[model samples]
Every structure is written in structure tokens, then in C-alpha cells.
Target: MTHRWLHLRLAAPLVAFGDVAIDHVGPTRDFPAASALTGLLANALGLRREETSAHQALQDRLVFGAMVIRPGRLLTDIQNAKLEKKDCGWTTWGQPDVRTGDTYDSPHRRRRDYLADHDCRVVLRLHDLPEGPDLDRLAEVLDRPARPLFIGRKGCLPSAQLFAGWLEGENALEALKAIGLPGRAFWPAEEGGGTVRDISDMRNWRTGLHGGHRRVSEGEIA
Candidate 1:
């Protein structure tokens, strides 16, 4: 079935799109992942975490694409954190308070990777579903999200608007050029340049079994 694609822009001073870190370093992908984009859509629609049906239905027929307007700078920061046991009445984490809970002196060295001044044009190709939360509904939500939207992390918000409009043509590259943004057309690749290492699995966003992207090519939208 032919799908109608939506053109949106994900521009933020800083944005991080990656999975939980298995190592000591938390790295961000070059571009946003499909799951992350879907998460943005879900948030715009105000879908709950337990609403797997809504999430899955949207994932079933979706294609994600991106054009690099500003690749941004690769920056990693060293974060010193403590192993704590719950919060202290929203005061802060690891704050000593017998009324709340005892905190541990577990100092953890975490390396957080981020992209400064990152910007990109995201294309969301969604199928026409019947039950609920259709692409048309998503388009409306993007115009005026039920809740305020952010990029990937809460701290990182979009510096510019999110929605561009409906895609004009079928060609992905053409659609991107129509926006008139100046940037390179890069895609997922296994080797060399223009590759995106994504942790979000398009097949299953939760399990991530089919996750771990090798690379992204310009025309190939997975």
C-alpha cells in the first residue's frame, strides 16, 4: 500500500537519540532513530507507556528518513553520579535524608555523548490505518501537540519548529530538497561515511531484537 509521508524538522541545540548504554559511555546517533521519531509522535498524541497497541499499530507501517542540514559537532562530557535509592521527596537524587531513604556512595563515571547545534529534516511516511491514531491525526497533533514536545531528552528541546508539512512527491530526495534546506544527503551505511548507528528497532521498538542498525543509505528507508 502507498503511504503518505509527512515532512518534519527536528532541530535542537543538542539532541541525543540512542538506547541505554551497555558500556560506560552513552553515545548518540548521527541522526534520530525511527523509534525516537515514533516516540515524538506518540508524545504529540499523548499515548501512554502501557499503550503498546497504539505504539505498535503506528510502527507496523512507518518509514523514517532524514537529510543532514547541519551534522553538528560531536561532544562527549564526563558525568559524575551516585548510586541512589529513590528520590528524596523531589528534592534531588542522592541527597541525604533519613525521611526519604539512605543514599549510597556509589560514584559512577558516565560518559555522555551529544551533538551540539544538531539539525536535520525528518520524513515520516505513515500508512492509513483504520482503528485509531492515523497519520492524519498525527499531522494534526504535530501542528499542535497535546503536550509540549522535545527532541529526544527532556533537557534537549527543539530550537526551531518541528512540522514542515505534507510531502509533495514520492522521491525522498526530492521531497527533502523541496524544503530548500542546504545540507548533504546521507543515509545508513555499513561501512565508510554517511552511516547511522541506530539502537531503535523498527520491527520492535521495545524488545529491540531487530535493532542495532548497521548503516543508513540515502534512498533506503527502513
Candidate 2:
């Protein structure tokens, strides 16, 4: 039995609209990508650490979900792809709604159009391994960076589990075997990892791009 490790990448932080509200709000109150990530991980993986400790650790390490989106369509196209039952290679990780709010500026209008009604945005970005998924194609079509970070520092849950699956086409189990995770252990472990903690605790809401937000200045993640 092999266990598989799926690494989800998350952007920095930003504001997000949610039914729940935080104590005080500000540009800094933008979603705490790190904090939310920790909650998600704890819920997904069912870590043994205390809630507070896990939250702090996940935040400090800056771990979160990842998605590969088409370039100019980072906002709109990705959403459409997802809406159309197409996979953006998104994980069960956190993402904000990009259709609302007045805080984003992109060179491309398609992205603006898609995000026009959503209020959530990405902040920082985490890289994914090439073999992990082909966000490259999505990036190429958009003629922009393949991977994009959420700029809004916020959080919302849409029950979007399109990315979660029992398998990843073509016996990913074989890949896990090659990687040394026992096959029998793979599925259960992955499910456990994805459902480690309280989903609500992972809520985040922060928007507004600060000078710190950055795209892939280096070459794409081949």
C-alpha cells in the first residue's frame, strides 16, 4: 500500500467576502492565507496538533491550495473551466470568489469580466511540480503566467470539490508506488489529509493587492 502526498500551493493573502465577519477589518485583515491553510490542512489531514498550534504552523509555513489557470483568463476562464466541469487542476484547498468587489486590476479584461461578480481574490502563490498537473496549457492559452495567486486576502466556501477525486487518471497509484508510498495506504491517507480539521475554521477574507504580491518572475514551473 502506498501513500500519496499532494502538495497544494496557496497565494499570500487578501480580503474575501464571507457570511462571517472578523473583529476588525483592514487591508492587513485581508485573508490570512497561512491561517486558513492551516485550518484546511488540519481538517483535511486530521493532524494531531492542537487547533491553535496547527493554525499557527500552517500559516507560518504558508501552505494552501493550488490551481492552474489559463493566463489572461486567470479570473474568468478558470471559473468558466471549473463551471463547465473542466478541471483547473485545483485542489480541495481554499479559494475566494472573484466575481465581486472592486479591488482588482488586470491587464486583461477577460479576467476582469469573470471576476466582476466575485469578491474573493488570491494573494500569494505556491508552486506546483510539473508532473503534478498541466496548468501550463491553461497559462499558455492566456499568454500570461500559468499560475496565479489570490490577491484578495479573504475566504469563502463554495463546496467546490471538483478537484478532489478517488483517482488521478491512469493509476496514480503506480506513481505513488514509484514514489514509495504504499498503494493500500494512498487513498485513505489522501482522504484523511483533505479532511483533517474543521472546514469553517479555514474561512478567510482579505482583498487588495499590496506591492508584495508577485507573479512568477522566474521561468514557469516546468
Candidate 3:
């Protein structure tokens, strides 16, 4: 049987600018209800901010739900229910019946193939920016030359560095950051190591995987 999971939804799109956007769909904590999984997935795929073609297939799901796919698999022809507040049930990209998998490896290849066909890539600009329990704490932790950036929902796009900027009134760095890290996953560490691993081996020196690194800055923080 196919394993299933649900995530919660939080926050909404606040702004959109040029190519990048911002959204407040992060979870309140680590609850298990619904999540911004689809949003992240759609965003990652570099789907044009105005594209709604795939929204119906994965809306109102949790960020965690998007990670349910096995590594190196594609998820295509996947369809969703026509209603909200539901599981957003899914099917294969091309086939009718649920694309069944035999072993865990089966699902991985399937998902990888589906994503390849649809050209999926997650966007994570806001997540790349700094975020902590509080802005103050976040500010302290994010005082590096590397400007703060994150993934945005819809309306929340970075323009003048007004809200999600290092300085309150700067745009140069904002624009530069936008070009550098257009996607969002750059912010949150993958579950295990790459993208969907359950637990990352902090001591995986061999793989060069460990604790997170601060986005370095050009000059000293002013």
C-alpha cells in the first residue's frame, strides 16, 4: 500500500516582485495537519510566478507531504481533487490508476520521472533569508555579509529590501540575492542530507554533510 502523510498550512503570499515572491505559509511549529509542500514543490520547479497550471494538483497540502516521494523519482500526471480542505488525493502523471510501486525503489524512480516530465523545481528565496524565533533573534543570528533572503508565496516578492532585506531601505543586495539564490530549499536543510532524508548525519564528514553554514557576506556587517 502507498504510505500517506498530511501537513499543515500557515501564512500566505505577502508580496511579489519581478521573478521572486514571498509567502507566509510556514507551519506554526512541527504540527501534522497540512503544509506548504505543494507551494514549495511548485516554486522549486521554477514555475513562473503567474503559472497556475499545477496549483490544483497540489494545493492545501503540507510542506512535508511534498517530501513523501522517494529520492530520485519523478511525479507526473499527478491530479488533485477539485476541492480544498481535502487530502488533495493524487495519481500518476500519465496513467489513470494510482501508479503502484513494488519496493521503495519503485516509488523513487516514478517520482523522479514524473518531476522530469513536468520540469519540477522548488523555489525557496525567503527560506534562504534569515529567520529565527523572533526578528531580533533572527537579526542577531543573520548579521553576516550574506544578505538575508527567503522564498515568497505570491504577492510577497522582493523589490526594495523593504521587509525581507538586510537593511531596511536597500535594493541592490536584494536584487543580487534574488539572482544568486532564486530557489527556496537553500534555506531549510534537507531532512537527512540531500532533500528528503529523514535525519541528516551531522557527522557525515565523508559526504561533507554536517551542520548548516551561514551565507557569508562580502564585507563586515554595518
Candidate with best lDDT? 1
Q: Which run of 10 residues does model 3 get worst, by summed lDDT?
A: 110-119
RMSD of each: 5.3, 18.0, 19.8
Q: How well does each candidate superpose onto the true structure, as a TM-score?
A: 0.76, 0.25, 0.19
Q: How many residue pairs clash in each candidate?
A: 7, 67, 63
The local lDDT score (0 to 100) that residue 88 gets in candidate 3 is 33
Best by TM-score: 1
N/CA/C clash count, model 3? 63
Q: Rate the local accuracy (lDDT) of all candidates.
A: 0.69, 0.28, 0.25
What's the TM for model 3?
0.19
Off by over 4 Å in 3: 2-27, 31-35, 60-222
Candidate 3 C-alpha error for residue 193, in Å? 30
Q: Higher-TM-score candidate among 2 and 3?
A: 2
